[model samples]
Target: MMPPTSSAPHSAGSAGALLTDARLGKKPAPRLRRYYLEPGLRKELPKLHQILAVDLAHVVMLAERGIIPATQAARLVDALRDLRADPEARLRIEPERGSMVLQIEAHLTNAVGESDAGALSTGRSRIDQGATVRRLYERNGTLAVLDRLVALQDALLALAARHSRTLMPGYTHLQPSQPWVFGHYLLGFANKIHRAFVRMLEAYHHLNLSPLGTVGGSGSPWPLDRRRTAALLGFAGLVENARLGRDIQYLADIAAAACLIMNEINDLATDLQLWSSNEFALVELDAGYCGTSSIFPQKKNPIALEGIRTAAAQSMHWFSNVLALCRGMGSGDLAMRSPGHVDAVFETTADMTDLMTGIIETLIVHPSRMGARAQLGWTTASSLADLLVHQGTLSYRQAHHAVGAFVRHCVENDVAVTDATAGLFASVTGLDMALTDAEFRSALDPATFIAACTSQGGAAPEQVDALLRAAAADREADRSWLDTEQHRLASCNAELDRAAEILAAARPAGSHHHPDLAHE
Candidate 1:
């Protein structure tokens, strides 16, 4: 539906009139329904429960405030509950009607007649109700994504814990650069994803505020207790500005967080995709996550990672679209504020995270292969440079140049890193190799390089263990947030159900005493 035309509620039997008098005297064109109204209805199907919850809470609040008679409120509440109970049977989007409230009115008219059903929007407009529903629905999407992210992080942390000392070649500009620990790499992802999780959770707090009572960007004539509806709907607080309540920046924040999440997923998935390839063979996806190429007999493709990358790229496009649509919109710019498929992006993001978590949990690592590759790339050259600075009485830059020259000499002479000697190093760099044979070999050892990296956030086993503990704590905190929010929302829903049932039962006529009314 749309905003109410005036402060007054529409007449009883003329259902859908609230959206009708948009200064357009005629009904929406049939073409409009096909292009716009039809798809909007299908989108609302997933949001049907949220729509009813908002209406139920509003009607109960009206009853609690004595705005409508107790008997009428009882019927209205019961009718809404009925619609909620069997929505598939009771609700349908008529092309001509083109409004959820209208459908509700038709069903309510059947149950309680139109006169009482007309009071359903007593102190509110459909616009405010829609804003409220959007918030609730998006809250659910946010939590769904967060739940998956937490599980993904937990899986990453578990893998990191097991492979604390596993060695690999770290890359710079896609070229092998240094010795790296797999556990440290995974922890980096854990930390990165947690940042986006924080952004989403923060946005959720702003998103949780109630916009229900901000009817048409202004308060209505009735003494509508906004707080009562907020409580029933599980809002943390009111969206204090009635106008600003209609739209908020949290939608963009959520979109941005989703983009960041997908971007992180893209990077990780790209790495996994590469690692699982025939050339790298550092890791392999489980058979369940792989797909056999129909045309190629021997190919077991890393299809899950490919799917994640595809979804993530789409999310970036959606993120850019959200920004494009949201820019230059006013506070009440309903047309563009809820512009596009932010919800779809959220669904896709959560799905990909779930997919990644499965991939990580069932992954098969080839440590021997990873270590063999790590040792072959002269990845320990930097460690030798550090040793030169310490023992060769050379400056750090001088040492870097010397090591660079040695690497070039080894490449030109077809000599492996293990074949380097003091005479060979001296011949290459024209400098004395102050480090003895044992010291030089230790410096070139990939394991020794990683072990010596004792700085915080380093590849050293102890450092990685510290990061693993931090990651565990971070994950625990994230889990606590998810659990607490789920419980809060669940308990609020139960209370709403209980209150609706309480108000729906038969009550004494002309006796407005309801248990939900605040104590004087």
Candidate 2:
């Protein structure tokens, strides 16, 4: 909303007036329409119906409090219901209007006559109403993302269960460093996505609060039933500080959470892109997700991975821009509070997550290729070094140096480490080794290397199984919370509908006036 030049923002002059021409004493510039008014109408067109949804609650609360005549409120409710049932059919844009809500106001006034339609804004400002509406819409967006994340968690856990002991090369500095269980790799990302679930829930807690009844950043003179309206709207509670209604810092919080999800997505997408390469050949995306080059018939590019990566890359600054727009500007600068890009951030991240979920569900993993890669680059050398320290009288450093020398000798002689025996290590290092050939060769075996990882959070099969169970438990909790919130919102909608219907029915067929309803 455009802040007023004089009075506090969200005031009659700033927000509620249909008299932009009369108050400003001039027509809005073409640039104002070109940039803000026209685009806001088009961009907000899909949600124009929501204006009635908010106003219904507001009108019902007004009639219940006897702030307006029952007859007038009934006329308004019936009109609101008609327009809301088909907003596109009932509402149209006029170039003179400054906002979509203004267009709605003009349309509603026309439908039910001026006095009754105008009663909807009695003790509220568009600032709080828009904030409430944005929160409600964003709650829907957040839950949508959570729904996708749950699907992703299911996919990850299922794949992890299938590959619990599937040994693959673990990488550091883009080089093979150790043998890692494929299940462990997937579990790590599942945990990361769950963290995003937690953060979004935290955002939802703040976003679910009601901002209604805060008229122009000050409490209304009317004995407004703020709590009642909040209940009707399904808000968790009221935003008690009227001034905070104008503080949209919660948008930055949501953006920050989305940024984290995108970061994890980028990491996974980049790794999968690298893994799907001909050289790595460890994993292959489904043909449905891959795009073939028109010029190169042999190419089956992982376009979905590229798409996920591109989506994440562009949204890294969503939260940053939100913070930038909100900070240093005082509360009176209401326009700074609502950043539009956060919606795009959530939308893109949800798409990326959903796309990745499909990729995971249909992914093709080459166990043979992963096994081969796991064995190359002397990935099991650390096992040999540890074994030497335990069996021989060498300190840890001495054992590491001895193993390094043996590795270099094997490379020079074109000997695979798997082919080396105790005699070969002793002959190369001239060290008296207590280990037998079987024990020495076993230390270099990838399967033995995996079995030996008995630490609390190791690559061992038991450890991965326990972690998977924990992930399952956490995912179940998240799914339950999402379900509860969805049901609550649905219940609130039903309640709001029932309340509007009752108030609309209070008017008689030929009743002259509702003097009793004013105080009823």
The TM-score obtained by model 2 is 0.93
What does candidate 1's lDDT look like per residue over 77-193, in tens digits? 876776688776556445455656666665566566657767897888877887888898888899999999999998999999888889988888878899888889999999998
Model 1, residue pairs in steric clash = none
Per-candidate TM-score against the hidden true structure = 0.92, 0.93
Clashes of each: 0, 0
Which window of ten consecutive residues has the lowest lDDT sum in model 1? 511-520
lDDT per model vs. reference: 0.80, 0.81
